[model samples]
Target chain A: LAKTTQPISMDSYEGQEVNITCSHNNIATNDYITWYQQFPSQGPRFIIQGYKTKVTNEVASLFIPADRKSSTLSLPRVSLSDTAVYYCLVQGSARQLTFGSGTQLTVLP
Target chain B: EPEVTQTPSHQVTQMGQEVILRCVPISNHLYFYWYRQILGQKVEFLVSFYNNEISEKSEIFDDQFSVERPDGSNFTLKIRSTKLEDSAMYFCASSERADTDTQYFGPGTRLTVL
Candidate 1:
């Protein structure tokens, strides 16, 4: 599995855009970048996923650079309810997901 | 949005006692997984089940831990002997497919072992 590194914490005010970047220096060719969000006392919720370039959905947008060494999760117009831990996972052929210390995003009012 | 559901939102058990945590995955999903998170810690994968059998498991899934799809709808995790370290939030998730499919997770079962 490819190890991922992301910010430990980030603060954003309501209505501001939030971009959380994750670096996977040793990412494999077959790996895909996926993101999940988790509030306290709840299971992690899938946000978005991408293999390369950019992918956008109703929830968020994923921006993968040409090198694929890193990816960014962009959330537009953040709200107080968006406060949670954001996890950036590099998914490989392995069935199990290896989670790292996620970035805690604090959306202030 | 069909989501996974887990029973017994909270469970309190004594040390050495057996506990069974149950889950009902999305109706059409094929892959199932179990993950746990200690308070204030990162989520850790325990095991993944597909086609009524286990596909992979982490070191944390020791002999004391077992998973079963007893029936078509219910997936269960059994802890033969609970320890204090077993106290955590157990989450059950399922994906429609293996590769690139998004996994939907349940609210989780908080197991407190004393």
Candidate 2:
């Protein structure tokens, strides 16, 4: 498993774009980067995942540079409901998954 | 979409007592995992089960903790002797595959030890 570091918190306004970056300098070739969004009192939901380059989904987009040392999660046209803690996880074949403290995104009204 | 479901949304128990947390994962999922989030803390993995046995477990899972899929439709985590620090939100998650598959999580069971 590779360790990841991300911002503790971020502030964004409604209708603005938000990008949360995660750094995993020791990421391995077989490891994949995955992002999950968690609301208060609920379980975390899968947002997007990428191994290399860019992967876009209906909810968000994940961009991974060639170096794979870091990845970014981009959310377009955010709303107040988009406020939640986002987790960046780097996992390999083994099942010993670890989650960081996560970045809490507060969307201002 | 089918989702994982857990029993007794909230449980309150006394210290030194035994408690069981039950969960029903997504029907077709193959791998099952148990995680806990202490108040104001990050979610930590406890154990992962596959093929009727534990595939991996974290250091937090010691002799006091145990997981069992008693039957086809139920997965349970039991703590033989609950302590004050055992109080936390327990989440059950399952995935269709072991690698790179999205693990669906269930609404957690909030356990409060008095």
lDDT of each prediction vs. the true structure? 0.95, 0.94
Error of 1 at B113 (Å): 0.7
Off by over 4 Å in 1: none
- Model 2: per-residue Cα lDDT over A26-109, one tens digit each: 999899999999998788888898999999999999999999999999999899999999999997887756889999999998
Residue runs of model 2 more than 4 Å from their true location after superposition: none
> Which candidate number would show the highest DockQ if scored against the true structure?
1
Task: Give lDDT tens digits, candidate 1, residues A42-92.
Answer: 999999999999999998999999999999999999999999999999998
DockQ of 2: 0.75
Q: Assess candidate 1 and give its lDDT.
A: 0.95
Task: Give the per-residue lDDT of model 1 (tens digit) for B1-114.
Answer: 688999989999999999999999999999999999999998999999999899999999999999999999999999999999999999999998986678899999999999
What is the lDDT, from 0 to 100, of the residue A23 in candidate 1? Answer: 100
